[model samples]
Target: MDVALQALTVLAAIALGVRTKGLTVGLWGAAGVLVLVWVFGLPPGSVPTSAIFVIFAVVTAAGAMQAAGGIDYLVGIAQRVIRAHPNQVTFIAPYVAWLFATGAGTGFVYYSILPVIYEVAYGNKVRPERPMAIAPTASQMGITSSPVSSAMAIMVGLMAPLGFEITNILSIVLPSTAIAIGAAAFVQNKIGKPLDRDPVYQARLAAGEVTAPEPVDIGVASASAKRSTWIFGTGILLILAFGIFEGLRPVIPGADGPEPLAMTTMIQIIMLIVALVILLWCRTRSADVPRAQVFRSGMSAIIALWGVSWLANTFIAANEDSIVEGLGGIADNAPIFIAVALFIVAALTTSQSSATIAIIPIGITLGLEPWQLTAMWMAVIGLYTFPINGSQLATIELDATGSTRISRFVIYHSFTIGMLVMAVVSVLVGLGIGGIFYG
Candidate 1:
């Protein structure tokens, strides 16, 4: 009966992701775990914490960033890049989507960038779906390999006992990200009418009014604010420093273990604080909206992540053993298994952080080698399933046709295809295992 209930709960969460609707409502399926906890106590002591503090922090962080026009700054940059050279849009779109899907969480990326891509596609007589494909696939690469991502963190811990070095592990996973992006691009071009002169979306383009998109309003420089290049340098320095922190975390001699902190969480905290200070400094000198409004925007955005985190944690706790076992058990066929695991967990959790925490550690423990582990990690980048994933969702919302609903059948089945493709390749590439089991 308990197993049956777990199955039902899992189905419910995936159903929401698959259907591309009732996003917040879809996450409600995880509440089933709270009920289970009431009945079964808890899964384990190390179960992912879905506490309120994270919720507070996420919401506050978003509010702060938005108030400072950080998201606006990003959008302006994307638009400039896409508009400058139209043909490049087809090729670079996937990488851009992947970057967002991985770094920003698929849902946030989808929601934010979809409008821009939609406008770009519409402007160029390109199929909206063509560009859409890249984001989901690319997203998988970005998140799985990202040090700040939870899955990477989990794998970092999981691989430690297996004698895997983080540096070598990165080398293997990076290529897989490229492969996922390449495959997504291949598939997109095949399905989509070529932008130079395509028919399917072209008819729609003719019917639809095309116009120049508004240049993004990257906030103007304040007279009081120094117009020096230091801000740009600061941003670059922050990124480089972040990379250094992420790369060095695993080598810190006590970075891995139960209840240990991941570099992502720490860096995120630091970044959040820096963002807040930047906001405050800018707000004080420049006459903008009231301070209250400034704070509120970032707050609202951040709040959403907390609920998102809970949904990720709850689902994993309920089905941790099955997920880890299922993925890890694919010993001889490890790469394929990893691919399947990536899609399944990403679809259900929306946030890679939660899925990574649930699955990566277990796969490592099950004897997946660094290459195999990286392959599995790389294979996990399928991002198109749930529109809730920030980037994919952004794509769907971006569709000017008002007809970009991603049916459950399409996403789940597509994932199946993607996994099989990667799996078969993994076998040929010596990354898969046909038979292995560990508990």
Candidate 2:
């Protein structure tokens, strides 16, 4: 009865989400599942870690940045770049995708840039679907190995018990970042040209499809006109140095590389602080939004992801054995299956951190190299680049005119196809790659 009720509750949550597209309700669904399983003693673990502190910190940091006018500034800069080079739209698209993925999480990254994407589609007669697909898909590419990503952090934590070393991880997994990025660009070129030829896309561009963007009210930050570009560069250098060393820490025989060396959260905190200091020193202006409003934006961004992640973790924790068995069957012979499974999980959960927490531990038990597991991580990142992501939601709020037309399915499937292509690549080279990593 407990198991049945749990399953029913999970189904209800999913059904509700599908019907309303309400992330909040989906979270409730996860909570219900947790109640059924945890309170009823269905799953094996004692209790899933709430990870509330992590979520709170991420939200606070985001809110602080918004208060400082960071996101508005990003949007302004992105808009200008897109407007300046409509022709390079395909080429520059990845950078735009990467930027959103970096801090905002892939789904929210998709949400944040929707207006820009829609406008670019309108201006260039670009098939918004393909570029839309490309952008979101690209955003997911980062998550598998991004030091800053919460999902990556979760993996770091989950595997900490196993003494997984970061240096060992880098040699095996870091290469995938380059591969994933290249794969996204390659797929975009292949898929994007076809989208351009679609009659609907052509017709829409001919109709002058205008996504009514919110008026840009922010002050312009001269990215080029700054002595502190050097300071900015220095800060970035420091952050990277910190991150690289942190990534290497898991492999160190003893804990002496840098005192408190493993705390990468500190590295990012410092990075954000330095970014602010340099921006101020350079007198870099922010977008027109007030500081308070900016903080609100950041709070929105963080919560956009935080709620979904917390809920999903709760659900997976409740139905873990079932979830694990369902997913684990393919984990070994079906790396591709694991990848696809994560995409759906990410899409359903609408947050990679949640999906990663739900899935990766099971994946590890099913047998994965921490390195190859990294590739699997990329698959999840790609999945969340769907329209359901937070930034995509935020972007929708920007364009009241509804110029952005790709439905949730289109964004999800485009990324799905990208995942398939990567799977194909892995299959073709599976033996070679597998031998190198797992053997």
Highest TM-score among the candidates is held by which one?
2
Query: Compared with the true structure, what per-residue lDDT tens digits does model 1 show for residues 337-399?
Result: 655675576556554444455456545545565656555555444334544554445555455
What is the TM-score of candidate 1?
0.63
* lDDT of candidate 2 over 245-281, digit per residue (tens): 6654234344555344443444445545654564465
In candidate 2, what residue range of length 10 has the lowest lDDT sum?
46-55
Q: How many Å off is the CA of 29 in candidate 1?
A: 6.9
lDDT at residue 2 of model 2 (Cα atoms): 59
Q: lDDT of all predictions, in order shown? A: 0.47, 0.51
Regions more than 4 Å wrong, model 2: 1-30, 37-39, 42-52, 76-85, 103-128, 143-145, 165-177, 190-198, 201-219, 222-240, 246-261, 264-332, 382-439
